[model samples]
Target: MTAHQNGTISAEVSDFLLNCFVRSPSWQLWLSLPLSLLLLLAMGANTTLLITIRLEASLHEPMYYLLSIISLLDLVVCLTVIPKVLAIFWFDLKSISFFACFLQMYIMNCFLSMESGTFMIMAYDRYVAICHPLRYPSIITDQFVAKAVIFILARNGLLTVPIPILSSQLHYCRGNVIENCICANMSVSRISCNDITINRLYQFACGWTLLGSDLILIFFSYTFILRAVLRLKAQGAVAKALSTCGSHFILILFFSTILLVFVLTLVAKKKVSPDVPVLLNVLHHVVPAALNPIVYGVRTQEIKQGIQRLLKKGW
Candidate 1:
C-alpha cells in the first residue's frame, strides 16, 4: 500500500476531493432538482426504449440493435457520472475513495469512447443503408452487427483502460482536489505531484484517435450518403434522403457539438470561470444520454409504432 518508488505514492494518499459548482449550500440543493429531472428523463427514456425494442420483434434489425446498444451505453454513462454528481451537489459528499474515483474515471473514459465507437458503427450502418441499399441487407447482417459490437467493446475497453491506469500509476502526494463534478481523467491527473506530460499526451492522443477518427469517418459517410442522394436528382428525393439521416444527424450533431464545446471550454478555462468547463463536462454526459433514445428510438417509425401499441394496450 506504500510507495513503489517509480510507481504508486505512499499509502497516505487515501481519497480524492471531488469539487462542483454549487454556489450556496441551500440553493445548491435546488440545482439537484433539475439534474434529478434530467437523470430521471434519461434513465426512463432509455429503459423504456430498451423494453420496446425487446418486446417488439419487428424491431429486430441490425440498426435497431445498434440503437439499443447506444441506449445501453447511455445508461452506463449516465449511471456512472450523474448519481455521484447529484450526491456531491445535494449532500456535500465530495470525497471519493481512491478506488471508487479510479473506477468512475475508467467507466467515464471507456464508455465515452464506446459511445463514439457506437456512433461510428451506427453511421456506417446508415451509410450502407443509403449508399448501397441493395447490398445493405447482406452488408449489415447479424454477423456484421455482432462484429460491430465486439469492435466497439474491444477498441474502447482496450484503449481507454490505459487512461485510468496511467493516471493511477502517478503519485498523488499533493492534495486530491478534483476541480470538476465527475472523476474525469484530466481532473484526477492534475492533482498528481508527478509530471503529467504522459498523462496529458495520452489523453490527447486517445481523444483525437478515437473520437477524431470516428467523427472523420462519420462525416465522410454522411458526405457520401448526401452525394448519393443528390445524384438521384429526382423530385422530393433530397428531402426523403435527409429525413432518413435527420435523427441520426441530430443526435450525432449534439454529441459532437457538446464534446467540441467541452474541449474549447477546457482551452478557454482561463478566459471563463472554472465552473463553466466543469459544468459542461457534467452536462455532456447527461444531455447526450437523455436525448439519444428520444431522437433515435422514439423518432424511428417502428419504435414509435411499438410505443404506440404498448400505450394502447395499457390504456
Candidate 2:
C-alpha cells in the first residue's frame, strides 16, 4: 500500500510539472507572421548583396571579404533562431523536447560568438588601415585575412561547443515553459532540477571573458584609429578615415548593445515582463540582420553604384 501511494504521488507531480511547462495559446501568432516576413525580406536582401559582391571580381578586397563573412554569420544567426520562433508561433509547439531546445540554444550561441569574433577582427583591420597605413598591405594580406577568419571560426566554434554539451547533461525536472519565444540559454538553465550553480557560473565567466576581451580590443583599436586620424593634415583624410570606419562602428555598437541587454535580462533575478525579453531578443536578432545590408548599401559607394546599376538594368 505504501509503494502504491508513492507511485500515485510521483505521477501527480509529473503531470503538474508538465502542465507548468506547456505553452499557453495566445494571439501572438498573427503578429509573428508579419514580423517573420520582414525578417525574410531582410535576410534575402543581405544574402543577395553578399553573393553579388563575392561573384564580382572587382569586389574582392579585405573589407569586402570581411563584409561577406559578416553577412554569412548574420544569415546563420537569423536562420538559427527566427525559423524556430516562427514555427512555435504557427504550430504552438510551446514545449520543445529537451534535445531540440538544447540544439537551438547551442546554434544561436555559436553564431553569436562568431559574430563577436568577426567584429573584433574587423576592428583590428581598421586599426591597421588607420594606424599602420604604410604596412597595411603586407600586414593584412589576403593570406593573413584568410587565416584570421579561419582562426575566428575555429575559436568560436570550439568555445561554444562545451556550452551545449554541459547544458545537455543537466536534468530538467522543473517546468520547461521557456518564457521567451526562443530557447535562450538562461531560460533553459532556469528549468533544471539539479543545482545550476555551475551552469550559471560558466555562463557568467564565458559571457564576460569573451565580451570583455572583444570590447577591450575594440576600444584599444579605436583609440589608435582616433590618434591616427587626428595626426592627418587634411580634413578630407580625417573625414575619409571616419567614413571608412563608420559602418563597422555602427554595426559593432548595435551588436554590443543587443548582446549586453540579452545577457543582463538573463542574469536578472527579478522577473520583468516576459514579453520584454522576447521583444528585446527578437530585436537583437532582427535589427542587426536588417541593418547589415542597409549599412553597406548606404555607406559603400561601390555597392551603392552596383545596386543602382543593377536596378537600372532591371536585373
Candidate 3:
C-alpha cells in the first residue's frame, strides 16, 4: 500500500476502535424509562396527599404539618435527580460534565441528609406524644415544630455543600466510567487521579458521626417511649402508643440498614454488577421518600380520612 493510504487507514481504524470502547450498554438506557415513570407516579401520589392534608384545616396539627414538609422534600428529591438520571439512561450518555455531576451529588446528599434529620425529629415528636402525654402540647408546640423543620432544612442543606466543593477539586483522568446509575459521591471519587485519602476519611468521619448521632437520639427517644408505654394501665392505651411509634421505628431501621450497606459497599474494591448497585441506589432513595407518605398516611387515621374526604370532593 502507498504510505498516504496506509496512514489514512490506520487513523480510521483507531477512530473506530475508540468509538467502540466508549459505547455504553443499550439495556441500561432502556431500563431508565420505566424506572423514571415509576418515580414520577410516586412523586405525584405524595404531592396529592400533601396537598389534601394542607387544604383540610383539621389536618393542620404539628405531626401532619411536619409530614407535609417531608413530602415536599421528597418531591424535591425525586424531581431533582430522576429526570437527569432518566435522560442519561435513555440517551446512553455515560459521561456527565463536572459541574452538573457535582450539582447532582450535592442535591442528592442534601435531600438524603434532610430526610434523615426529619426522621430523627419525627422520633422525638412521637416520644413526646407517648412519653409525656400530659405535656405533649406544651413540649411539641406549633412554634417548636416550625423551628425544628427550619433547622432540619438548614443543617442538612449546609452539610452537603462541603462534599461537592471538596470533590470538585479532585482531578479525574481518562477512565471515568461510573458503574452505578447515578453520579454518587463514592462512584465519582473512584475516578479521581489524585489521592482520595482525604475524601475517604471525610466520608468515614461524616458517615459514622451523622449515623451515630441519629441512632443514639432515636434510641434514647424510643427508650423513654417504651418506658412510658409499659407504665400504661390499659391494654388499649399501650397498643395505641406502640402502634403510633411502630412504623416510624421500622422506617428508622430500614433507613439505617440501607445507608450502612451502601456506605460499606462503596468501600470495597471488588467488581460488582452494575445492575445490583443501580437497583440498590434506586431503593436507597425511593423507598425512604415513598415510605414516609405511605406509612404515615396509612397508619394515621386522621390523614387517611382527610385524604378520603378530599378525594370525595374531587380534589
lDDT of 3 by residue, 1-315 (tens): 112533322111110000111234665556566667668666976987789887999988887777777788778877766665666655644556666777878888887777778878889999989877899989888899889988877877776678878777776542445655676777677766778888777766765666567778888999999999999998599998999987778778767787777656645526554355555665677666666677777787888888899889998
Residue by residue across 35-125, what tens digits does model 2's lDDT show?
Answer: 6876887688787788668656677888788888888888877887777667666765455666666777787877877788888888999
Ranking by lDDT: 1, 2, 3
TM-score per model over all chains: 0.93, 0.87, 0.84
Q: What is the lDDT of residue 170 in candidate 2?
A: 66
Indicate the worst ten consecutive residues by lDDT in candidate 2: 10-19
Winner of 2 and 3 under TM-score? 2
CA lDDT scores, all candidates in order? 0.85, 0.74, 0.71
lDDT of 1 by residue, 1-315 (tens): 356667655637778878677433353566688879999999999998998888888998888898888889889989988899888876778989888998998898888888888889888988888889899998999899999889888888999899889988988766677877888888888887889999999999998999999999999999999889988878998888788888888889878898889789878878887777777788888998898888866567888899888878882
Name the better of 1 and 3 by lDDT.
Answer: 1
Sliding window of 10 residues with minimal summed lDDT for model 3: 11-20
**Residue 307 accuracy (lDDT) in model 2:** 70
Candidate number achieving the greatest TM-score relative to the actual structure: 1
Name the lDDT of candidate 3: 0.71
When 1 and 2 are scored with TM-score, the better candidate is 1
